[model samples]
Target: MTQISINGVQRQVDADPDTPLLWVLRDELQLTGTKYGCGAGLCGACTVHIDGQATRSCLTPVSAVGARKVTTIEAVDQGQSARVGQAVQAAWVKLDVAQCGYCQSGQIMSAVTLLSRNRKPTDADIDAAMGGNICRCATYVRIRAAIHEAAKALA
Candidate 1:
């Protein structure tokens, strides 16, 4: 059994060590906010935070996350990333960023992590952090603009 803290709650997950965390969150905890994109860790769709660092939940195992904070988008926007999500969501609304909205969760997760790390990120910095996140609707321009707008809001 692997012990994990998810969204401030502690739970013991009994599963294979190699079982992907995405399944654990969705199946066991029923937190569906964290999506499953590529399942290969290439896409950022399964992004979640482990100890405040953005990590791909699809490629991560339950055993690997022992005794660490596993925050999904459900809690992210509600607890820790509320203000950040607000700023980003406001910018997203202003910029009309969502098209299909399938990938927005991952995009927002990456953006929030970036904003948390660098309060003021240049275009290149944003690009570097957001490069792996693929938006099928191709909302890169609006996403970038929203990040800048969120930074402005933070400032």
Candidate 2:
């Protein structure tokens, strides 16, 4: 059993070291908030924060996680990211950002990471930070607006 810290808790996950963290989170740990998009990491649906930096869980081997704390969408509003997470969620809701709602979790995760770092990201900065997360519903405009609103709330 390999011990992994997730959402501020330490738990031993019984799985192959080579198993992707995405499967570990979804299958082993049942933390299904992190969706499995393109397993090649092209799509960011499996995005999660590893030690405060957004990481692609689908491409990340469980063994590589080590001591990093993994924060999924399920607990994004609990720890260090609580304020930012709340703001992002509120902005997403107020802006009606989700259409299909399949990719919103990853989008929100990336947005939280961007806001946590920059706090005043411009369009270019938001684009640069969120480029990896893909929203298939073509909600790019609302996504950008929601990001801005979340930033304002955080400010």
Candidate 3:
């Protein structure tokens, strides 16, 4: 059993160290909020925060996590990231950014990371920060809007 820290809690996950964190989170820990999209890490559906940085869980092996803290969509609005997470979630909901909703969690995660670092991101900044996250529903317009609104709410 390997000990992994998840969402402010330490969990003993019985799995191979080489297993991708996406599988460990979904299958082992049942933290299905972090979805598996492109297994090759091309898609951002598996995005989660590792030590406050947005990372693709599909590409991150469980062993690589070590002592780093992992934050999934389930408890994003908690801990030190609370303020930004809540603002981003509220903006997402208020702006109705979800269509299919499969990629929203990753999008929100990326947005939260972006907002946490840059409180007021411009259109270019938003595009740059959210470049990795792809929304199949073509909700890019709304996603951008929500980021802007979230930044405003934070300000």
Candidate 4:
């Protein structure tokens, strides 16, 4: 059994050390907010915050998490004291950024991470930060607008 701190709670997950953190979260912990798109980590569908940084849970092993705090989409709005995540979530809703809604969680995670560090990101910066997250609906235009809106709200 390995202990992982998830969403401000410590959980004891019983699985192989090599098991992906995504399965550990969804299967063992029942935190299904993190979706599995391409297990190769190229799709960014399994993005989560590990120690306040965006991390791909599908490619990350359970043993690698150690004492790091993992934050999923379910807790992103409530986890941050600065309300950056909440602002991003609000912008996403306001802009109707989700089409199929399958990849929105990952997109929001990446956006929150981006805005947390850079209060005002340029279009290029937004593209660079969000490039990994793929939305089959191709909502890139709205996603970009929401990011800008979130930045404005944060400002």
Candidate 5:
């Protein structure tokens, strides 16, 4: 059994060590917020925070996780204590960042990570941090706007 700290809870998962963390999260843990996109890790749809760094869960092995804290979109708000995440979420909603919404979870996760590192990210910084996440709806404009808005809110 492989044990992992998901969100903030420790759970034992009975799966192959080589199984992708994405499957473990979606299939076993039922934390479906992290979507599977470009199973090769090219897309950021499966983005999650592995020890506070935005990681592509689809290509990460369950065994590799070890003792790292896995933060998903479901717990992005940190149960109301995540100021950065809440601000990003609020900005997303306020700016209407989502069109189809399939990629919003990953987008939000990446945005939160970016804001955590750089409280005042410029357009280039936002683009660099979010370049991997693809929104089929082409909502890049709103996404960038929301990131700027979130950064201002955080400031």
Candidate 6:
């Protein structure tokens, strides 16, 4: 058994030390909000905060987490950067950004992180920061627009 603090609570999960945190979070803990895209970490769908940094959970082993703070979208919505997320979510609803809605969570996660770090991110910054996330529906235009809208509100 290994102990990991998810969001804020400490929980012990019985699994391989090499098991990816993504599996531990979704399978054992049943936090399905984090999605699996490319298991290799190319996609940002599994992005979560590890010790306050956005990390790709798909490539991170549970054993490596140690005492780091892990925050997902569920808890990120209430985090210090939550207002940015709320603004982004609102903009998403207003712009109808989600095509299939599968990638929106990851997109929102990345956006919240970006907005948290860069209060006024430029188009290049948004592109560079959000480049890892893939939206199969090709909703990039609306996504960018929504980010701009959300940034306006957040700023």
Model 5, runs deviating above 4 Å? 79-81
Clashes of 5: 0
Please write out the lDDT profile of model 3 over residues 1-155, one tens digit for every residue. Answer: 88989999999998889999999999988999999899887779999999999999999999999999999999899999999999999999999999999999999999999999999899999999999898888999999999999999999
Q: Which regions of candidate 6 fall more than 4 Å away from where they truly are?
A: none
Candidate 6 worst ten-residue window by lDDT = 76-85
lDDT of 5 by residue, 17-126 (tens): 99999999999999999999899988799999998889999999999999989999999999433999999999999998888999889999999999999999999999
The model with the greater lDDT, 1 or 2, is 2
**Ranking by TM-score, best first?**
3, 2, 4, 5, 6, 1
lDDT of 4 by residue, 1-155 (tens): 99999999988999999999999999988899999999999988899999889999999999999999999998998766349899999999999999999999999999999999999999999999999999999999999999999999999
Ranking according to lDDT, highest score first: 3, 2, 4, 5, 1, 6
Error of 6 at 77 (Å): 0.8
Error of 4 at 79 (Å): 2.6
> What are the RMSDs of all candidates, in order?
1.4, 0.6, 0.6, 0.9, 1.3, 1.3
TM-score of each predicted structure versus truth: 0.93, 0.98, 0.99, 0.98, 0.97, 0.94
lDDT of 6 by residue, 1-155 (tens): 99888878899999899999999999999999999999998878898888667789999999999988888878876666668768878899999999898877788888888888888888999999899998898999999999998889887
Runs of candidate 3 with Cα error greater than 4 angstroms are none
Instruction: Point to the candidate with the largest lDDT.
Output: 3
Give me the runs in candidate 1 sitting further than 4 Å from their true place: none
- Candidate 5: deviation at residue 74, Å? 0.3
